[model samples]
Target: MPLAGLFAGALGAAIAPFALRLRGPYLAIVSLGLVYIGIYAARNLPALTGGLNGTVVTAPVAIGPVDFAALQVGPFLLTREQGMFILCWGILALVLC
Candidate 1:
């Protein structure tokens, strides 16, 4: 659920004070170690993460009237890849602006 993301965000905020203490290569090493730990957890925790094979994430594809699962612009209907491309770039452009 989206609440999980909020929890993660709160966890990160709480951990920032400790994580920000490290500098230079220490920070890099810690970040890399966290990545490895996540990978290891995902691989070992099959029930939670679906293991190394990964799992399908079927989240909602619509926001209001815009349905990304079947995105249409004018007369053209976009494929999933095309929709994703547009969505990603749109986000990027919005951030940049």
Candidate 2:
């Protein structure tokens, strides 16, 4: 996930200059074109995206000793959704800082 974020960041940085230069309708057109291209690629790439069927991406929801999937804090046990909420907010706070 971190690597994917990094790759997306890099791709965004690479495109920013050209994207930033456009204004109004031209920017909207370009953005729409890129979105279509992305959708088409995802639909066609079977090995990478599972084509039209799509793919499931699963990763261990643990950070060292803390397992977000089944988080236990003191006497309180959190449900998966609650644990994920906390984990996501924590990450967002860290990134914002």
Candidate 3:
């Protein structure tokens, strides 16, 4: 998600010059068109965005011996929601710090 945010920032920076060249309604139209363009690309590109079927994320979330997907701490087992809660808060804290 951080990488995606960075990529979006980089993309905005690169496009800023061209977008600035447009004034008033033209700029608004172009900004609105970007959404449609993204939808079109996602719908058309199966190999890229997985098209209508969508893609699955197979990555594992782990820290040392604890796999967050199947988290076990001593006799206690954590659920997926618990893992995500921990992950999200950890990321938020990291960003804040």
Candidate 4:
């Protein structure tokens, strides 16, 4: 799921058109209002945004033959947390480069 990147790109594109029509404090207030509205919706909409308590994730962590759920390499074995920690930082490093 390209969820994070997708939302970020879409938000940029969505705001760009409006940005041309807004300026200074007017734009700032509008942006702040939108953020407050978004937060309110997340809090009130139970099914949509998990009602602020948040949602449980049950996604598997895997990359080709490397399954993070039960990762083992020669003499090294890693737990789910350890595997995901490596994967996340590794991806961050790759993106930074």
Candidate 5:
């Protein structure tokens, strides 16, 4: 997923030089269409995205010596959230780097 985002960003960067050639409504329409298509693709790929029902992601790390599934944190205790946060931040850092 992180790699895919990186590729997309690279593609966008490559296209940026040409984007300036487009003007006004033409540029807006093209950009909006791309956004719509990306959203549509994500929604349709059930195995990849799990659609509106959402998807299950396992823990990125165990909570100390305990099993991550058995661990609790505050009221909304879940390993998935921690995993996602780590995943997102890791990707963000990769992008920044």
Candidate 6:
């Protein structure tokens, strides 16, 4: 899905050469209109995006062979907080990569 968005953005950039012939204010208006449309779509499509309240996300389970449920570090046992920490760091690593 991210790759598809990247491709779509590239296609938009490729088409910008034609749009560049337009006046600066016209281009800005078009861009702002598109942004408004995107925001409207996101708000109206509740079934797809969960509306303004947002959506619930399940935490991931384990890190490689080490089961998160079984992990115990010092006095702290692995629970929801640790699981969330692992999940967040994993996502961060993926984004950085």
Highest lDDT scorer: 2
Count clashing residue pairs per candidate.
0, 0, 0, 0, 0, 0
Ranking, TM-score, top scorer first = 1, 2, 3, 4, 5, 6
* TM-score of each candidate structure, all chains considered together: 0.55, 0.53, 0.51, 0.48, 0.44, 0.41
Q: Write the per-residue lDDT of candidate 3 for residues 8-95, one digit (tens) a residue.
A: 7997898889999999999999898888887998898879777788556677777777678777667988887688778879889999
Candidate 4, residue 75: Cα displacement in angstroms equals 12
Where does candidate 5 clash, by residue pair?
Answer: none
**Predicted candidate 2, C-alpha RMSD:** 5.2
| Candidate order (lDDT) | 2, 4, 3, 1, 6, 5
Could you give me the TM-score of model 2 versus the true structure? 0.53
Q: Which of 2 and 6 is ahead in lDDT?
A: 2
Write model 4 residue lDDT over 49-78, tens digit each, in one string. 668676566799999988987888679998
Select the stronger candidate by TM-score from 1 and 4: 1
Q: Write the per-residue lDDT of candidate 6 for residues 1-97, one digit (tens) a residue.
A: 9986996699689858977888889988877876787689779998965678865656556678866655677887887667667777878999999
Q: Of the candidates numbered 1 and 6, which has the greater TM-score value?
A: 1
lDDT by residue (tens digit), candidate 5, 1-97: 9998997999799878878799999899879987987789788986876676865655345545744444465675666556556556766999999
Overall lDDT per candidate, in order of appearance: 0.82, 0.86, 0.83, 0.84, 0.73, 0.76
- Score candidate 6 by TM-score against the native: 0.41
22 in model 4: Cα distance from truth in Å? Answer: 2.5
Candidate number with the higher lDDT (1 or 3): 3
Residue 83 accuracy (lDDT) in model 2: 86
lDDT of 1 by residue, 1-97 (tens): 7987997689779867878999999888978887887789888999987778855757766668887878999999998778777878888999999
What are the root-mean-square deviations of the candidates from the true structure over C-alphas? 4.6, 5.2, 5.7, 5.5, 6.5, 5.9
Record all residue pairs in model 1 with backbone atoms less than 3 Å apart, i.e. clashing. none
The alpha-carbon deviation from the true structure for residue 90 of candidate 2, after best TM-score superposition, in angstroms, is 1.3
Off by over 4 Å in 3: 1-17, 22-29, 47-49, 71-78
